[model samples]
Target: MKRAAKYIIGVMSGTSLDGIDIAYVKFNQTAANDFQILNAITIPYGKEWKSALKEGFHLSGEKLVKLDADYGIYLGKTILKFIKENNIEKVDLIASHGHTIFHNPTENYTFQIGNGPQITAITNIKTICNFRVQDVALGGQGAPLVPVGDELLFSEYDYCLNLGGFSNISFKENNQRIAFDICPVNIVLNHYVAALNLEYDNKGAMASEGNIEINLLNKLNSLSFYDEAKPKSLGYEFVSETIFPIIDKFNLSINDILRTFVEHIALQISKKIESNSEKTMLVTGGGAFNTFLMERLQSHTKTPLIIPDENIINFKEALVFALLGFLKDEGKINCLKSVTGASKDHSSGVVYEVESSKFPFSR
Candidate 1:
């Protein structure tokens, strides 16, 4: 008999501490490069959870472990609630791109908390998570893993750029997908904006008022990460260490800082897009909503930029993570060797199963 289609919930919490994006998808393997998104939803993080995750990188070993377990259980409960509300049935597994904590691949250590085992135990569902560790272990950046999804799901776009907590772009070069983090986005923007007791620069209004600090802009545009080659990724540590200090030196107002950083972001992103002029680029993620930033980028590049629906822009990463899980469950290569600079294309993520018979979780 033919196997039934698999229903999976893909969970993701990006570096911006935006919240967990859970996508409930029914995936069918029609062909190698064909798949569809059935249904999806983004769950906003509560204040307490957001605060805890924002400071997660500073926690100690034991506290971090506790947070991991607690967060996992929280995710499980959230998933169960989502399923009930949506009336979803026949879920095969939960694929989670847990919140990234420490991502220093040069040190040979990377951690994405939200314990998968705890998730399975609480939800009584099979879980697949920690998608970055193995790729890093094989001497890769352990990031920008969504390119495979971009490749398969939206292959028509010549370039796929996501402006989430960080700005990263992926595109075909000599028949290979090359992707890397361009610059910090909301992670840095939100940090400064939060100091003003605001959550974010809604619609980029605050950034639109202030003048760009030419000195700060020049200094930011000259950062070493910009000079680095492709297949590289960035983490929170880079911002805390390299970006924050420089921005802190100037005693500028919040709006000025926002303005300068927005320009810096536009400069970095446009430079990459200009490097190739042959095709249309699909841009998504939270930063895509930043009108000022988008305008700045448009000023610098000549290539046509296409912004999809709000759902696709917001949930693309989550949708891609769901695709990652589907590929992993089928023993297919999900991690792109070209994008991550891994030794080879590999299936990444650890599967955890709950020791329960009540929920009837099956593939």
Candidate 2:
């Protein structure tokens, strides 16, 4: 008989650089298609780590290698603390999304740091990390990996839209799962807000106060990425190289920039949430908490937006990475070719096992 696995810890760091979200999930395969999210938590990144990660784009060679190893060590220690604090006893494995540094699938390269060996070495627990490299190597976008989770775990909604550093949406179309990045969200929003000495624009209050710059809004809305086809994704590099320069050219006030950019985000997202027979959309991520952005989305679309409990809103990505790990462990297809434009559907993640006396660890 095949025994069921019960517990796992999933870790994720979004491009927004908001924080590292660690979710302690209890997954049970009740039936062929049903699963449950038992419990979860998201730990905000400290100022020091946040700054270091923000600067990761400029790092290269030895500096990047050292940062990767250091970040891996930090992740291992953090997982240990989370395990002890939660009194979680039956953990099957630790699954991490790591921090994405470079993701240009066009060049056949994508990197997410946080070494699996270091994690297992520190926590003495089986670990699964680096979920994206293989998919990208297979010529996929190496992104929007959460669609598999969205399809299996939250299929109840007509559309699953995640408002993270970048906004991405997934849904069923012609009996196939379709998804793509909508536009930059917190990645650009936070950049400008940080200049005001704020970590984030709480509830988008600052944006709500600022007046929209019509010309800037028009220029932003005209970005070419918006018209791109599905199986696409976005990264920090796009924002730093493309978005920042456009926004900087205006020399506008921070408030005006925030307001106009918020509109741009809302407009881009609204275009993707196409009206359909099914009217309900499930929305999650840090941007979901942005009242102004949400209002803008709601204003433009007739579809009803459903925001679930705080746990689901804040830690859905972390929870889904847990599902990804579970699927990988089961040898089930966790990465979808339809979503990532991979050559084929595949199981992903490099696994590391802890050294244990009773249950021998696998290399």
Candidate 3:
């Protein structure tokens, strides 16, 4: 018989390329949100893998297919190493939100590498992945999926905002969950910081030193995407085709660019944080550590912004993907209509499993 509680490993790779976030979680089947995070870690990508994934967008169709298979194998080996290092022995399932290579929901196509079958074949465990495709097929943004976890696992918060590569917010409005990307965050900031040979703006110190360029700031704030209604999402293409070009036109110092962009981000996000009397915002992800950005964000709204612990800040998405897999395993809805603009609420993700004797993964 199947067990009520499950020990599962959830994996996620965000656009920031910060690394693969791995969370070993235990879910109590009898009660929702009754879960324990036994262990968590981020496996930084080597330059080789990073370059392969980054340059993959321009690859030929044949090469892209090969890269997909290769990435699946890479993910499997990495996960095996994580298991061995953590001394985790009893994983009931694996949920992998493979790195998104392409996402254009308007055209109804979104792809994430790391094959589910390959993951199961290597690990010899049941696996669930490709969580976004089904939602896109049903006419949805196929993003901000973590809101399902927010609704069930973190209902106490008035708003759940994640500041990853991009800033996205989720909250209950009229009893329906609504969420959308606010603006580009580290995806833009880190891009500029890399010019200085730095991984990030530690505590937003560099940005705090520069003066905001009003002209550039106004240009960023005037982007057409900001006025668009919800049920939308952003991709790396937006940054390349729209955001960077606008910023590059103004030949300003890197610090000035970061400073202006931070203001633009704060202003855009703050506009969404209605000056409520009792509501609070739970902020997480890498951007939460940027003190200067946080201060600017706090200046615009009366809502108390709560910064969670480092574990939650770094691994919350991985944790939520774990929750998504758990719900999918039980045949429950893991995608939301309001959040993803899907036709209807549905259980998303393809499940895979290979018998131990038939495992084809080579050692």
Question: lDDT per residue, candidate 1, 118-231, as tens digits?
Answer: 888877888999999999988888988999988888889988999999999998888998889999999999999988778789989999999999999999989888998878
lDDT of candidate 2? 0.88
lDDT of each: 0.87, 0.88, 0.91
Residue pairs clashing, model 2: none
- Candidate 1: residue 290 lDDT (0-100): 87
- The estimated TM-scores of all candidates read 0.95, 0.95, 0.96
**Looking at candidate 1, what is the lDDT of residue 262?**
94
What are the per-residue Cα lDDT tens digits for candidate 2 across 1-363? 655756888999998887889888877677534555665666788888898888888899999999999999999998899888878787898899999998899888889988889999999888999999999989999888988888888888999999999999999998889889888989999989888788899999999989988988888888888787878988888898889999999998898999999999888878887765367899999999999889998888888899998888999999889889888888899999999999999999999977657756567
TM-score for model 3?
0.96
List, residue by residue over 1-363, the lDDT tens digit for candidate 3.
555789989999998888899999999766677889999999988878888888877786889988888988888988888899988889989999999888899999999988787788888889999999999999999998999989988889999999999999999899998999989999899989988878789999999999899999999899999999998899988998899999999999998999999999999998987778598899999999999999998988888899988888999999999999988988999999999999999999999975656657777
Task: Give lDDT: candidate 2, residue 341.
Answer: 98
Worst 10 residues of 2 by lDDT: 31-40
* Whole-model lDDT, model 3: 0.91
Candidate 2: residue 208 lDDT (0-100): 91
Task: Write the candidate numbers in order of decreasing TM-score.
Answer: 3, 2, 1
